[model samples]
Target: MIPKESRNELALDTFIKAHPHLLEEMKELSAEDRQQQILWAFEDEAESRGLEAWELALELIAR
Candidate 1:
């Protein structure tokens, strides 16, 4: 799980705030683009946590 402090550094809440626009665009994206965006966000969060990529992938997938 991501710590609260890490969440701030990753600007996760900020990203989520901009999600409406992203979501709208996402609807028009191919499946691969959607997956890429999710992976990018996951990687950003994982970097903030000093976690491995696989860990982040698992966490994100679980959600």
Candidate 2:
């Protein structure tokens, strides 16, 4: 997993962890672009969980 300190960073690390096949796909993007995608995905998960984006990111990061 990536050593992440922020929401977007955590999102990317979480995404790649959950989807190993997508790791290769993620590697092709520029860092900024990859983080953007992960941010979107993280937001989606947060919404589904009825929590704010940063809240979930922080919780996940802690674990």
Q: Which candidate comes out best when scored by TM-score?
A: 2
Each candidate's clash count: 0, 0
Candidate 1 Cα outliers beyond 4 Å, as residue runs: 1-25, 57-63
Clashing pairs in 1: none
Instruction: Quote each prediction's TM-score.
Output: 0.44, 0.58
Candidate 2 lDDT, 1-63, residue by residue in tens: 544565556655875687676557688899788767767776787899999987777777767
Identify the candidate with maximal lDDT.
2
Show the lowest summed lDDT stretch of 10 residues, model 2: 1-10
Estimate, for each residue in 1-63, the C-alpha lDDT of model 1 and write its tens digit. Answer: 876556443553445454556656677778788757755875676889998766654554445
